[model samples]
Target: MEENGLLNDWTNEHPLFDNGQGDKLSRKSIAAIVKKYAVKARCVNPAIIPEGISPHSMRHSKAMMLQDTGINLVYIRDFLGHSSVTTTEIYARIGTRQKLEAIEKTALSPEPGSLPIWQRNRGLLEMLENPRDVVFNYYL
Candidate 1:
């Protein structure tokens, strides 16, 4: 929280990840450090870990995790410090399994309490006669 100025908190204005010598760790160095940790984790859990994980993939996973919780892409963009929303929108793209799961949630049935008008009114028969006008959507 303090490193990011989040929750209106502060832990000395010093850089959070600093080299032992005294200066802040550069972005390249941070990536290397993250990879080192990933390698350590991979050794402990070989079955769960992939061979070539990096900090960038970790960032992508974080963005996707936030999207999974239904956070808006605009907010995600800001949270990731992205200059454009398009950059953040990539995380919102759903996988095929996610799409299938979402589709499975819909209950397929006729509109509740709304009987087909054409069934009772002969005048409305044109709706059923015209294929273009006949909408078979059951999940509203």
Candidate 2:
């Protein structure tokens, strides 16, 4: 399994446990490696990463990135090797990133104390019918 002398051997280096059936890298060892790499990645990108991040979060983030671009859930499920599509659907949430981007792209900034003309008809009727109750009844 040698490829450019990077991995000279693909077999396990040591017995997994006293049972002597599994590979050298146990689940605990893989978990520790994942945690170590996660910490290293956080150190490199503190602004993008949040506290208490784990290895799974990276998978979730990748799925979310694809989801934001309107990628298919089935493709994402297969990419993540999920047994069920439902598991992958959890990563499709339109979180703060998409919300903020949409708002920044489409938000209309009205002048102070002035509604957009699109609402002028409604405002005019409200003003003429009941100006006093307009403040109490109008809800943004």
Candidate 3:
């Protein structure tokens, strides 16, 4: 191999991820490579590669990882070759864990004394305790 025009001892004719002809691997070739590695990985641990894992799933995983890292959705859209940001917005939907994390991060802790007197009123507590006793006057 050559590094900055300086010859090195590394002597592989093809790149580690290239096709045998020193060209970029085709989509099918890439899928085949992923499948081969997945099979090998399954031998080590079946949970590593679940059934029906495909190249598309890897792409989706990468998109999710990018979203989790706070990368802009527009950038992720471009990276994933989406026609519009709307298409990329699917990945922006927060999971349950992310929703909880966001809530925890922004949760407010107010002093008990800061609440209005109405909030602590016994009438309000009684109303909550006996919802069936309350009558609705929607016309009013």
The candidate that achieves the highest TM-score relative to the unseen native structure? 1
Report lDDT (Cα) of residue 73, candidate 3: 93
Any residue pairs clashing in model 2, and if so which?
none
Candidate closer to the true structure by TM-score (higher is better), 1 or 2: 1
lDDT scores of the candidates, listed in order? 0.65, 0.66, 0.68
**Ranking by lDDT, best first?**
3, 2, 1
Model 1 TM-score (2 dp) = 0.59
The segments of candidate 3 whose C-alpha lies over 4 angstroms from its true place after superposition are: 1-16, 102-140
Report how far off residue 117 is in candidate 1 (Å). Answer: 30
Model 1 clash pairs are none
The predicted structure with the larger lDDT, 2 or 3, is: 3
Candidate with top lDDT is 3
State the lDDT of candidate 1 residue by residue for 52-135, as single tens digits.
667777788788778777778899899889999988887666533444445446524447786443344443344334434565
Residue-wise C-alpha lDDT for candidate 2, range 23-140, written one tens digit per residue: 4665566667778877788788877556666657767889988988878889989999999999988977775456445544654767899854435557645643454456643332
Which lDDT tens digits does candidate 3 get at residues 1-140?
24433254463544555676668688898888889999999999999897777898888878878887778999999999999999998856554345445544654654776744433555544544454476533110
User: How does model 1 fare in lDDT?
Assistant: 0.65
- How close to the true structure is residue 110 of candidate 1, measured as C-alpha lDDT? 43
* RMSD of candidate 2 to true structure, Å: 11.9
Least well predicted 10-residue stretch by lDDT in candidate 3: 131-140
